[model samples]
Target: MAYTAKDASTTLFRYLNITEQSIKVIENTNKRGFIYNTANGEKCVIFIYPISHKSDNSKNFFDTRDSGAYERGVSWNYALQNKLKYFCFAVHDQVEKYNDYVFSLECQEKIIEKVSGTLNGSRIGAGTQVVIPNDYIPNKQFERIFTKNGFFIAVIHRDNIIDYIDKYDNRPYLIDDSLIELDELETNDEDSSQSVALDDEYLSKLSRNRILFGAPGTGKSYKLNEDREKCFADGNYERVTFHPNYSYAQFVGTYKPKPKFRTDGTEYVSYEFVPGPFLRTWINAQNSIKSRTNKNYLLIVEEINRANVAAVFGDVFQLLDRKTDGTSEYEIATSEDMREYLIKECGFEADEIATIKIPSNMYIWATMNSADQGVLPMDSAFKRRWNFEYIGINQGSSKIKDSEITLKPYGTVKWNMLRIKINDGLTEAGVNEDKLIGPFFLSDKELKSLSIDEIFKSKLIMYLFEDVLKHRKGKIFKSDFNTFSKIIDAYNEGEEIFDFDVVSFLPDESNEESALGSVAEEPGKYSTENE
Candidate 1:
């Protein structure tokens, strides 16, 4: 049983000892401050906000507010150390007018328990609050704390929670669920600083190729976008979208004609070189080169396979193969050189060509839809040059659940199981290897906006097992198409399946072939190999 919003809300209200009506307006100042209701002898405060913003609102306990004259004399320290059975607050606003204020000293022990319960029942938010430290020292025990709603509020030190509210009114403007802290928060600034501390020698360990793979909807693109921004050294990164027609000229550079109109009303043809995204990223990385540190450039190639990789990428592909001396051997005009070249060679002025680049400090990240036919027949030469990671369809769990924009009822485990089951069913029917659903099929945008049940069937047919689509509809025909259709149709025709719980499928490492191909239940796996 995992924690839920309702459970958190109920526990918080219980801690406050208040009815639903007692909560005034829920504040989301993003600052880390605990709203402890000393009204009860319990060392607990009912978080006035509901589950809607609970995760966002409660982060770290940094400092306390200016409870002003109203907060004075209320000893939180006294409540923690001694077996003080009673704690009280003089509220500027009367909370008792709405609800009965029946509190007993016996409730003191229960207050901490209730607060613990609220904290324990939910893990969706940011900060993980452990026991409240008394005599909390800032530099020693506590650094700074933020509210759940992402407000950087206070610095906690022994006996005092100091306020340091900023422009956000202590609110976190942007929340990235995907960038969850895998490890515990570091107290030391040196270890936890945002700056990439590694030098050239350290960069060698990270030089090996990295691949992002999973079925569709697993957030490959989303993660790539995040890394795109982070991978650059000095805010100099480039991104390129690959399509079927992307040419070699696009990746490198090509001479093209542009119309130039003079003030004298005479129009003439001007030849200029245009640099593409990959070229631009490579160029930017070189421009920001710093001494001592090996400068790194990021070139993100989205849908890498849509274009004929070999045809469009040609000599660059050869260049990528030999990671030796990555700078271009030929002396060519850069974007700056292109401007100079056009003015000198073709008689055009400086303010014409957009941007240019040299190949040094360039790194490439190419994304591809594994399910697309155009991308399926990737040449071996192309494949050997880069690391490959498969993004499968069932990989939807993490992206769906962690996002604040959408609250997926289906959790990661559940979603993965569903994908496994679907894949198994499709493989049993002999669907083509390239036809299986990947992340491209399911739409996060669609799922976020529409309910799963509404678009479930169509999504299954259209995106989930798209490989099945061409096989059933086209020639070179193979497999029991109706069998796959029946499984999908049956799932759609059911109220029970909609009520399905993912926990039903326990983790199975043995039958994990469902990740790539579904192992047949027969004597051996069906030989889908065309040979």
Candidate 2:
């Protein structure tokens, strides 16, 4: 049977199990090609040209002296100039010497050198080959070229053509198109949309590092917990609390004295470098990236503003400036002890010990309460690097159910409503917005389970006396019960019981003059006496 360009195009499409509608055949006097679009919208072409041979023997793979060889070299240069990812295959007829043909390493090297010249300094090697392997194709490896009889198949794509290669064994004989399984190809195409959506969501959540900030009890830390669980598994994440005493030695890693037991059972103190949460998370991220797991490692910092971030981060602060690709902009040098520890205990290569960088896959998430008055202020330069998300107070009924407290005469009051009332009272008293009550303050499940008196004594009274009244004394209440002790006595002994009316302390919307004043003031001061 005589072979033709049309025959080759038909065979290529049949091998790939692609429909005719998805591929167009291009037949020319010099070459035959197939044009198609990948699932990712990349245009691709597979071109095949006949190689001149001096004899019918397969041993004579190509006639290098012939004009066909020069034309083939020109074609390769054209492909390179056009920036197309091309794979070349040399075809031959069956020869008596070899039952099955395999391109020798020597021939592969020659082909690579010839293609490299055409590429103009571009690298080309054995990896560029598209072949049907008799044995198993290793996992993560791609096969691109195939050969049968006197036909050589060449594939070119705008993107990485290797990604399209199927990891399955090729039969010695031409298999029917119906036998080919296109399930992997279809699955990959379907996953493309999902992958894009995931990327968008990931970018929105955090481009580099992010800090979720809000008033206390606004659920900033809770948001982090939900996100951590959604994005990563337990082993892939680590959480740490930052406070006034937090230091670089405790965050990154440090040399500390550890007790070691001798052979005789007596203990001896030895100085050794210990890895901290940040370092451990970084190491795990590096390993995951090296293994090509496509997973992210998370580091959660609670109460980030509580610590002197500059002092705690030290040289590691430089790592916060990330490149568009998400890698650290600078590699900070590690301490000698850290270097030694990384190489000896962490399995880092010797050459990698000089400097350390936070990997792109290692994400840092932090939570900060805006209500924290004693925290070390973060500078503009430091604050500008991180993405900030504000968690607002949630007034949902479900959330309110977590802390519904019942009182005499008042019946049951939802924490959400109480929060709104208290915030309104604070606003009327001219207190700062940051000092306003957040719904989370009274939403604890344990607090919700408490009796009315217990709830008032344990949470509400403490919040009023310690947080609110401590800051805005007599300005928030009437002169008779201006102090917390007076208010507590009124509620406990039921003396001057009218002062214990919590609702009376909230602003009244019906009276315009008293709208900006708390109901705790003398009745006739802001509003007219009852008619």
Candidate 3:
């Protein structure tokens, strides 16, 4: 059962051993609230607001409505004037209980948006009300209590008034005295709760699950690496590449044989559970939370689609549906072996070891290229959980704009320019976008290779021949040089290799630099070494 606003205040006051100083009412404004103080001299004002009928179990929130509205009226003005702390408790409706539990967050002093209504030429709610921002709520579940008939009681441990709220307030607050002292050396003990409000300016922004996909050499991996450094300042990250044979046991965890040493310095073989990247990342995230570091932990998968993604993720895939806070909306049970390992080696509490979840601070990002073959397909259900961002073929082309590629007889042209021309021709020939050449296809270092002809044939021409135009060779290569060997021979002998005019490959026909007039190396900004 759920308790009403008046009943909640009465019961909460008793639980906290609060001495009520009566409801302070301004007869003219109809402004009213109960003022109370704890034994340790923490003064606070409580405003009772009913839970909105439209609210659901998905989230616990409330609206100030007519209760807090005042002409030129505003939030916390009374508490501010009295120099008292402020708290608002939102009680959930009885009909929406789950497992005999009612869910409602215990947050304070948050105003996200305004409810526009007028009363005697004054804005309702004085333009601000107490409400938690969906994104700022912590991953921990809300506080709940049971009620029967009209009696209101708290099932929580008996403690001081401030300690009582800290137990169930899912909304983050500044709790440590050292941190509070660092911000303000002379924090008033009577109004200390005033400092617990969320910082409206500082937002913990992090995307939990994202997949960057595009053609080869599009800088997907490079971009992921760049973001990792910027996001994880403490360098908490684990990187792994997915291949055809990658499995859930290897991705998450599994039992493996281990060698143990006895007192006599003799080694003996034993079997035990071994954690993989997934478990290692989870443990780091849990430790970060326990320490209140508030830092992000990242898990980077180099080629997500290369392996059977659904099979590799297995049941853990369900954790991808993140809430506004970047945490999994649901938790999944872990294998018995995994539970024991997490609790023993990772310092996870026994109560929480049975289940696993992607915490609000743990992020999983991956890169995939749809153009590659021998890779498994991803189902719609699996794909929908990730935010698919396409890394365009020319996404960061400007960075490597100075690199040059040599033409058969037309001198040299910018590597990016030649790539653009080839991409245009390939697209015109009905080739897929994923099969087109990217700016980073040939690194500036590769362009300066002594065996430029061989490098070009193996890197670019072979792709165009073997895969891009496997069915139509003459579409890109010249009709006379139809076979892969013919194109290579013509390219090596300084003959036109493309079906199109050789001059078309050069940006300026006037550039008469010899094939050996290589472009000087430029600082590399993208990864093309393994493209």
Off by over 4 Å in 3: 1-206, 407-410, 448-451, 505-531
What would the per-residue lDDT of candidate 1 be over residues 1-531, giving only the tens digit for each residue?
423334434543453454455443222221111334343223332221211112232321211222111111122222233322222211111221212111111112111222222211222122222211232223422233322221222222212211111111111112222332222222334322334442445433232233454445456687566555444432334556778878888886677676655657799987656545555454334433422124476667777777787888765554554344555433433345446533442222354334322455666765665655566357765676566655444443434332222113334343344555555455565665445544334566655554765565566645544545444422211223334465455555542222224345534545444443432222112212111
Every model's TM-score: 0.44, 0.56, 0.58
Model 3 pairs in collision: 69-125, 73-126
Q: Is candidate 1 or candidate 2 better by lDDT?
A: 2
lDDT of 3 by residue, 307-344 (tens): 99989999998998888777898899988888877655
Model 1 weakest lDDT span, ten residues long: 163-172
lDDT of 3 at 126: 36
How does each model score on lDDT?
0.39, 0.52, 0.58
* Model 1 spans with C-alpha error above 4 angstroms: 1-214, 233-235, 265-269, 289-294, 323-360, 390-414, 431-445, 451-454, 464-466, 469-531
Ranking by lDDT: 3, 2, 1
Order candidates by TM-score, high to low.
3, 2, 1
Worst 10 residues of 3 by lDDT: 146-155
